[model samples]
Target: MFKKFSPSTDISGQTPVKSSMQRAIRSSILSSWNIDAETLEAIWPKKESIIHVKCREHISIYTLHNEPLFFQHFDGPVYPTLRLLHKYPFILPHVGIDRGAIRFLLAGANMMCPGLTSKGGRLPPQDAALPAGTPVAIDAEGKEFAVGIGLTTIGTEEMKKINKDVAVESVTYVGDELWAVQKL
Candidate 1:
């Protein structure tokens, strides 16, 4: 995966986030990721300065102290920042994949059912109950690092019934343009 990630050249201008926008961001994060308000407040203190950049046509990336924290898509829910993933590893619903799948994921491939059903891969117990299109963190099995974010294509029960089809569509993963853009 690391081999496939070339640094991005796209430049995005930063703008100070307003108080009303901050409140909306906080609310969206809480509802989308199921995090409590207090924890969200603690992670994003009111006094600290935060800014946002339009990284893509529809996506705006939020940063605090020059570190990317989260991003919001105009038509979708908020997405966890890779930085936040390291700080709060289990905050979002997740699927575990073996090391073999990491490279492909970083290369922008969708996750197949076997990656979640293989000996080294596993799905969260509650994932079977989640609706399609729910955001899910993708973590490596033994390393326990978040490698990607995806949206489930089907409910967990359906995922289990199939063996070779795509289970989750990759939205962003480590080493992709979103991650590389932060380095710019």
Candidate 2:
């Protein structure tokens, strides 16, 4: 099941990160998601670097890369815990969303889902992978923005109970309240 997170749970505290390292992390995240360098750089910017959870659970951020396409496969880290998915790979978020609600929506499904908690665009039907409650925003042209991350239940039916019509089995609640204006 997708677990929830809160501010008090921030184990990393507000530690500052180096710019070169930030660039590397952004590149890694883009590569893992198979986003091209050009697009990723456009959406996210090199100067914008910071990582934090919107709610206790969701990972919210804007990236140096603008590939909203990457968010369709929202399989980075499931929850906003101190733990990293090194078992698979690790790529820290650069610009995080500021609101919990947007975080919840992104955590729940890709931009493709209808009726997002906030009104943004949608993603394509490519093999998108949802982690849990990850919320994403799409541009008018259908690109994606990794607005916030999500927590999910293991089974699809269970997720539907929390949010009906949501295709993925994971249920998403908004992680950050300010994510709408920031990312979208």
Candidate 3:
């Protein structure tokens, strides 16, 4: 793994993490994909930091071997890597059709007056997990269309007005589960 590739370590000489906190992170991946413990350990960065998992994989700190392959090969019975972390267990970013409109917003979306541009219905309030620069998905009336990417902004209104200069927030996913399955 070191000849053709080089894994990085911080100044303290710690290896990458094996993300093993947060029941949401682990359970979502395992229950959805039937992943095992050994597999989860192999792909994660081997760190024990809460912030890293909360903000998704620490892409800046330790990158995957090949993210595209990681996703493609693993999109099986379970959802792809991104959906595993974005839905099911996570409470912050919720996906639901609020008041008959399919709205994908953060969990604490303004219910009384949902600032939805399109479909808002009876779906859950889970943050749609979007890849950076990719469109998020919203399904209403059996139709699925790509919405704008989930923003770093907190509310639906702020997301509409985000400018090019705004700082990018990290996207979350379960790459470890994919990697583990791929290795098998």
lDDT of 3 by residue, 109-177 (tens): 222223333354322333633223321223234434322122233344344344223222222222222
Q: Model 1 over residues 1-184: C-alpha lDDT tens digits?
A: 2223332433357798998988877877877886787788888887886887665456677788777788766768678767577678767887888778888887899999888878778786753466788888888878767888888888776777777789988878887766765643
Score residue 137 of candidate 2 by CA lDDT: 23
Please give the CA lDDT of all the candidate structures. Answer: 0.76, 0.34, 0.30
How far does residue 53 in candidate 2 sit from its true spot (Å)? 6.0
RMSD of each: 3.0, 11.2, 12.6
Stretches off by above 4 angstroms in model 1 are 1-9, 126-128, 181-184
The better-scoring model by TM-score among 1 and 3 is: 1
How many backbone clashes are present in model 2? 47
How high is the lDDT of residue 28 in model 1? 73
Ranking by lDDT: 1, 2, 3
Order of candidate numbers by TM-score, starting with the best: 1, 2, 3
Task: Point out where model 3 deviates above 4 Å.
Answer: 1-14, 18-83, 96-116, 120-149, 157-184
TM-score of each: 0.84, 0.33, 0.26
